[model samples]
Target: MYQYSEFDKQFVRNRAAQYRDQLERNLAGTLSDDEFRPLRLQNGWYLQRYAPMARISVPYGELSSEQLRVLGTIARDYDKPDAALLAEAQEKQTALGTVPVPGTNRQVGSELKYGYGHFTTRTNVQFNWIPLVKSAEVMELLASVNMHGIQTSGNAIRNITADHLAGIAVDEVADPRPFVEIIRQWAALHPEFVFLPRKFKIAVNGAQEDRAALGWYDIGLQLLRNEAGELGFRVQVGGGMGRTPIIGTVVGQFVPWQQILNYIEACVRVYNQYGRRDNIWKARIKILVKSEGQAYIDKVEEEFRQIVELDGAPHTITQAEYDRIAAQFAPPVLQRQPRDAAAQQVHQIIRADAEADPGYDRWLQRNVLPHRNPELRAVVLSFKRLGQHPGDCTADQFDAAAQLAERFSAGEARVTHEQNLLLPWVHQDDLPELWAAARKLGLARPNIGLITDMIACPGGDFCSLANARSLPIAEAITERFQDLDEEWDIGEIDINFSGCINSCGHHHAGHIGILGVDKDGKEWYQITLGGGDGSRAGGPASPGKIVGPSFAKEEVAGVIEALIDTYRQLRQPAANGRLETFIATLRRVGHEPFKAAANAARFVEKEVA
Candidate 1:
C-alpha cells in the first residue's frame, strides 16, 4: 500500500479546506446552488435521490486498516438520515411490494437500509444518506485520514482501478500498483482534463488472467514485456457499457511503460476536442471511437506525435519517478517467527481440519487464492450474503474487517471488482483462524464466484435514474440459492443485475444478465444469455443477447432457474471431469435452448404450495 507523503497529506488538507469554504459560502446564501453544483461534484458530493451521497475513492483498490476504521466511523456516526426522512423513505419502499416466491404467493419486500457503505465495481465506497449540511464536516474528517473524494464524481477521470491481486497474484508480469499510483497522481486535479465531455475510467491488469475486466473500461492497460524484454502496456480504448456496450479496441499494441501517460494524454486530448458534448447519452469517448474507428486512432496518433515533437512530452515517466512510486509498494514482512517447522505443523493441521470439516474444505477451495509468495494467501471476505445487498457493508462489518486486516493481513486490504474485500497479505498458516473469525462476522460464506455472488447496483430504491428496484431482485436470487451444495454444483457464474440501461452493475457482462425495465409504469425484467466479463472464467467481454420480451418481476427468478437447468442439462463433462461451465455450455450449444427455456418459464405458473 502507498503511504501518503507529507506533501500529499498537505495537498489533501488544503483541498478539504477549500471545499469547506465553498460549502460555507453556499450555506450562507452568498453562493447559489447553480454556482455550487460543479464545486460540490468535483469534491464527490452528489445530491442523490433523497439525500447527499458521498463517493470515497479507494485508488487501485488498496486500503489501510486505519482507512477502513475511518470509513466505519463515518458510517456509524454520519450516515444517518433524519427520523422523519427515514420514515418517509421506508414508507415509500414498503409500498413497492415484495419479491414473489415461485410455487407460492409468498412475497419479500425491500427494506430501506442506511448507515452502510456500498462497494462498487470500480472499487469505490459510497454512502447514500449523509446530510448535505454536514458534508463539510465529513470532508474535514476524511482529510484527517488522508482520504477524500476528489475527482470521484464529475465528468473527469474517475478513480483508476487495477486487478485486486495487483502485487500478490502468482501470474502477474509486474506489480502494476506503482504505475497505477503514477497515473492516479498525474490525473488527479489535472486542470486541462478536469471536465471532459463525460466521465472516463481507466483500468490496468498486470496478471495473465483478465481479472480487472480490462475490456469493459474506457482505457484498459495490460502490462507485459516486448520481444526485447522492454516493459510496456497493451492499451485498449473505446470500451464502455450503458446504452451502448462495446469491447475496447487495441489503440496501442505495446506503448512503452514510460510513455503511458503521454499516450493517454494524446487519446484524451483528441476526445476532448472532438467527442460529443451536446448529448449526455452519446458523450463518452467510446462513442467517438466507435463512430470514427481508424480515424479516431489516427487522430490520437497524430496528437501523440505533436505532444512528443511540439510539446516535448512533459508527462513521460522517468525511471527515478517510477522507482519513487514503486518504493512505496514494498511488501510488508510478517512479524511471525521462522516458518520451517511451524509451517509444516500448520500444514498438517490444515489437512486434518479439511478432512474433518467439509465446510472448511469448501471455503478453502472457494475463498482462498494463491499468492505470488507460496507462504501467503489472498483471502476474499464475501459480502454477497442472503440478508445484505450485494457489496454492502454495515458499520460493524467494516470495523470487523479492519480488525481482521490488522491481525492477519499486515493492516492492508484491497476492494475487488467483484465487490468483495481481499486480504492480500494473509499468511498461509492463518487460514483456519481467519475463516473462523470472518464467518462469525458474516463475511465468509465460501461463495466467491458462485451464483449468489452476484453484482448489482443500488437501483430504483436509491438511484433516481433507475427504473426498478435491483435489491429485491438480488435478494430473491440469493434466497433461492441458499443451498451451498446447489450453488457449488452450479459452478462459477456471473449474474450481474442493473436497474436501467446505465449498466452500473455490468449486467451486459454477466453470463446470465438481468436488466430492470419499465413498461406502463410497471417493473419488468429482461433476461439475456451468453454475456461475459472477458476473463478466463467468463470467456470474453461481450454484451448478452436478450431472450425474448420482458417478463414481470415475479418471473425473473423462475427465468434464471430455468436457464440454469438448461445449462445443467446441455452441458457436457470437461477434461477435468467436471461439468462444463454455464459460459462454455452456452457457447457450445448456442442460446436457443436457454432462450427458449427462459421465455417458456414466464407462462409456466407454479401451483400454490
Candidate 2:
C-alpha cells in the first residue's frame, strides 16, 4: 500500500479544512443551494434520493487494513438508518400483492449495521445515507485513513482503476498500479481540465484477461509487451455506454510505457478543447471522436507533439517519479512453503479433505485465482451473498475483512471492478483458514464470475437519477439462482444492471445487461446481449448488442433465466464438462438465439418474476 508522505498529508488536511469551511457556510445559508451544489459535488458529496451521499475514493482499489477498519467505523457511527427506504420499498411490493420472502439481513437497526460503504463498479465507496451537516465530518474521517473524495465527482477525472490482479496475476505483463497512481496525482485538481465537457473515466489492465472493462471507459489502456519485450499500453479511446454505445477505437497501438502519461494528457487536452459543449447528453469525448473520426486522432497527435515540444508540460511524469510510485506498490516478499516429502504427505491430507468436503472444494475452485508467485494464490472474497445486494458488505464484514487481511494475506487488499474484494497476496497454504473466516463474515458465496455475481448500482433505491430500483432486481436474480451447480452450469456469465444510462453498473459491458427505464411511470427493463468487457481470446472488447424489445420490470428475473436456459439449450456441448460461456457462444453463434429465448420468456401476468 502507498504510504502518505508528509506533503501528501498536509495537502489533504488543507483540502479538508477548505471543505469544512464550505460545509459550514452551506449550513449557515451563506451559500445558496446552487452555489453549494458544485462545491459539494467537487468533494464527492451528492444530494441523493432522500439524503446526502458521499463517494469516497479508493484509488486503483487498493487499501490497507487500517484504512478499511476506519471505513467500517464511519459506516457504523455516521450512516443513516437505511431501513426507512427498505420499509418503503417493501410496502410497494405488498401493494403489488407479491409477498417475496424477506431478505435474511434483518439487522437494519443494529449498532454496527452492515457495511463500510456501497462498493461501486468504478472501484469506489459510496455512503448512500449521510447527513448534510456531517459532510465535513465524513471528509475528516476519510482523511484519517489518508483517503479523500478528491476528484471523485464533478466532471473531473474519476478514480483511475487498474487490474485488481496487477502485481499478483499469473499472466500479468506489468503492474499498472504505479502508472495509474501517477495519472491520478497529475489529474487531481488539474486547473486546465477540472471542468471538462463531462465526467471522464480511465482504466488500465495488465493481464490478458480484461477484468477492468477497459473498453467501456473514456480511456482504456492495456499494458502488453512488444516484439522487443518492452512493456507499453495499447490505447483505446472514445468507448462509452449510455443512449449511444460504441467500442473504443484504437488511438495508439502501443504507446511506450514511459510516454503513456504524455499520450493520455494529449488526449485529455484535445477533448477538453474540442469536445462538444452544446448538448449535455452529447458532451462526452466519445461523441466528439465519433463526429470527427480520424480528425480526433490527428488533433491528439498534434497536441502530443506540442506537449512534447513543451517538454511534456507540467503534467509530465518523469522516470524518477514513476520509480518512486512503483516502489510504493512493490510486490511483497513471501517465504515459500517447503515442498519436500513431508510436505507431500501433508498435501495428501488436504487433497483428500478437498475431495470429501464439497462446499470447501467448490469455494476453492470458484474463489481462488492463480498467483504470480508459485507458493501464493490470490483470493476473491465473494461479496455476492444471495439475500444481499451484489457487492454490498455490512460494517461487520468490513471489519472482519480488515482483520482477515492482517491475519492471512498481507495487511492490504484490492477492490475489484466487479464490486468485490480481492485478497491479492494470500498464500496457498492458508486457503482453508481464510475461507472459514470469510464464510463467517458472509463473504464465502463461491460465486465469482458466475451468474449470481451480478454487478448492480444503488439504482432507484438511492440514486435520484435512476428510473427503477436495481437492488431489488439483483436480489431477485440471486434468490432465483440459489443453486450453485446451476449457476456453474450457466458458466462465466456477466449480468449487470444500471438504473439509468449512467452506466454506473457497467451494464453495456456485461454479456447480459439490463437497463431500467421509465415507461409511463412504470419501470421497464431493456436487455442487451453478446456485449462483453473484453474480446474473446485476447481480442478487442466490444459493446453489447440490444436484444429485441424491452420488457416490464416484473419479467426481469424470468427473462434472465430464459437467457440462461437459451444458452443451455442452444450452446455447443461442453468440452470436458466445462460449458462454453455465454459470451463465447454469442461470439460464435450471434445473439439471435438468446433474443428468441428472451421473447419466449416474457411475463404476461402481473406477477413479478
Candidate 3:
C-alpha cells in the first residue's frame, strides 16, 4: 500500500479546512444553495432523496486497517440524520406504499437504514445518511487517515480503479497500481479538465483476466508486453453504461508505458473540445465516440501526434518516477514459513476439513484465490447475503473487517469491483482460522460468483435519480435463492440490479440484468440477458439485450426464476462435462425461449393508474 507523505497529509488537511469554511458560509446564509451546490459536490457531498450522501474515494481500491477504522468511526458517529428528518423521510416513504412479493401475502418493507457505508463498483465508499451540516467534520476525520472525497463527484475525472489483485496476481505482466496512483494524482483537480462534458471514469487491468471490467470505463488501460519485450498499454476508450451502453473500442494497440499519461491527455482533450455540452443525455464521451465512430479515433490520434511532436510530451512518465512509485508496492514481508511443522499441520487439517466439511470446501473453492506468492492466498469477504443491501457494511462490520485485515492481511484490504472486500495477503496457513473468524463476523459466505452474489444500487430508497426502488427487488431475489445447494447448482452468474438508467449497479455487465423502470408512475422492471463484463463468466465485454417490454414489479423475481429454469432445461454439457453456463446456453439458443418463459411467468393483475 502507498503511504502518504507529509506534504500529502498537509494537502488533505488544508482541503478539509477549506471545505469547513465553505460549509460554514453556506449554513450562515452568506452563500446561497446555488452558489454552494457545486462546491459541496466537489467535496463529495450530495443532497440525495432523503439526506446527504458522502462518497469517499478509495483510490485503486486500496485501504489500510487504520483507514478502515476511521471509515467505521464515520459510519458510527456521523452517518445519522436528525430525528425529525428521519421521521419525515419515513412518512414520505409510507405514502409511496410497497410492492408485494409475488405469490405471497407479504409486502417488501419500506425501512430506512443508516450508520453504514456502501462500497460501490467504482471502489468508493458512500454514506447515505450523513447530515450535510456535519460533512465538514466527517471530511476532517477522513483527512486524518490521508483520505478524502476529492473529485469523487461532479463532471471531473473520478477515482481511478484497478484490479483488486493488482500487485499480487499470479498472471500479471506489470503491476497497474503504480500507474493508477499516478493517474489519481494527476487528474485529482486538473484546472483545465475539472468540468468536462460529463463525468469520466478510468479503469486498468494488469492481469490476463479482466477483473476491473475495463471495457465499461471511459478509459480502459491494460498493461502488457509486446513482442519486442517492452512494457506498454492497450488503450480502450468510450465505454460506459447509462441510457446508452457501449463496449470501449481499442484505439491504441500498444502505446509505450512512458507516454500513457500523454496519450490519455490527448484523448480527453479531444472529447472536451468536441463533446456535446447542450444536451445532458448526450454529454458522455461514449455518446461522442458512438456518434463519430472512426472520426473520433482519428481525432484522438491526431491530438496524440500533436501532443508528442509539438508539445515535447510533457506528461511522459520517467523511469525514475515509476521506480519511486513502484517501490511502495513491493510485496510485504511474510512471517510464516511455508514448510514449517506448524504449517504442515495446518495444511493437513485443511485437507482433512475439505474432505469432511462441504461448507469449508465450498468456501475454499469460491472465496480463496491464488496469489503470486505460493505461501499466500487472496480471500474475498462476501457482502452479498440475505437481509442487507448488497455492498453495505454497518459500523461494527467495518471495524470487524479492519480487525480481520490486521490479523491476517498485513493491515491491508482491497474493495473488489463485485462489491466485496478482499484480504489480499492472507497466509495460506491461516485460511482455516481466517474463515472461522470471518464466518463469525457474518462476512464469510461461499457464494462469490454464484446466483446469490448479485450487485445492487441504493435505488429510489436513497438516490433521487432513481425511477424505482432496487433494494426490495434485490431482497426478493435474494430470498428466492437462499438455498445453498440450489445456488451452487446455478453456478457462476452475475446479477446486476440498477434503480435507473444511470447504471450505477452495472446492470449492463451482468449475465442477468434487472433494471428498474417507471411505467405511468408505477414501478416496473426491464430484464436483459447475455451481458458480460469481459470475464469468463459471461464472455467478452458487451451490453445485455432486453428480452422484451418491461414487466410489472411483482413479476421480476418470477421472471428471473423462469429464465434460470429455462437455462437449466436447455443447457447442454460442455467439453468439461459440466452444464454450460446460463450465458453460453442463452447465446447458443438465442433469447426466444428465455423471453417466452419470462412472459409466461407474469401473473394477471389490475393496471395501476
For candidate 1, list the clashing residue pairs, or say none. Answer: 98-108, 534-541
User: What are the RMSDs of all candidates, in order?
Assistant: 3.5, 4.0, 3.2
The candidates, ranked best first by lDDT, are: 3, 1, 2
lDDT of 2 by residue, 156-237 (tens): 7888998888887778778888888888888898888899999999999888888787888899999999999988899999
**What is the TM-score of each predicted model, taking all chains together?**
0.94, 0.91, 0.95
Model 2's lDDT to the true fold?
Answer: 0.80
Highest lDDT: give the candidate number: 3
Model 1 over residues 344-459: C-alpha lDDT tens digits? 79767865765588888888999999998999999999998877888888888889999999989999988988899999999887888788788788888999999999999987
TM-score of 1: 0.94
Error of 3 at 593 (Å): 0.7
Could you tell me how far off, in angstroms, the CA of residue 390 lies in candidate 1 after the best superposition? Answer: 0.3
lDDT of candidate 3 over 158-276, digit per residue (tens) = 99999999999998988999999888888989897999999999998899988889999999999999998999999999999999999998989999999999999999999999999
Those runs of model 2 whose alpha carbons end farther than 4 Å from true positions after fitting are: 81-116, 310-316, 333-355, 535-540, 574-577, 604-606
Error of 1 at 382 (Å): 0.6
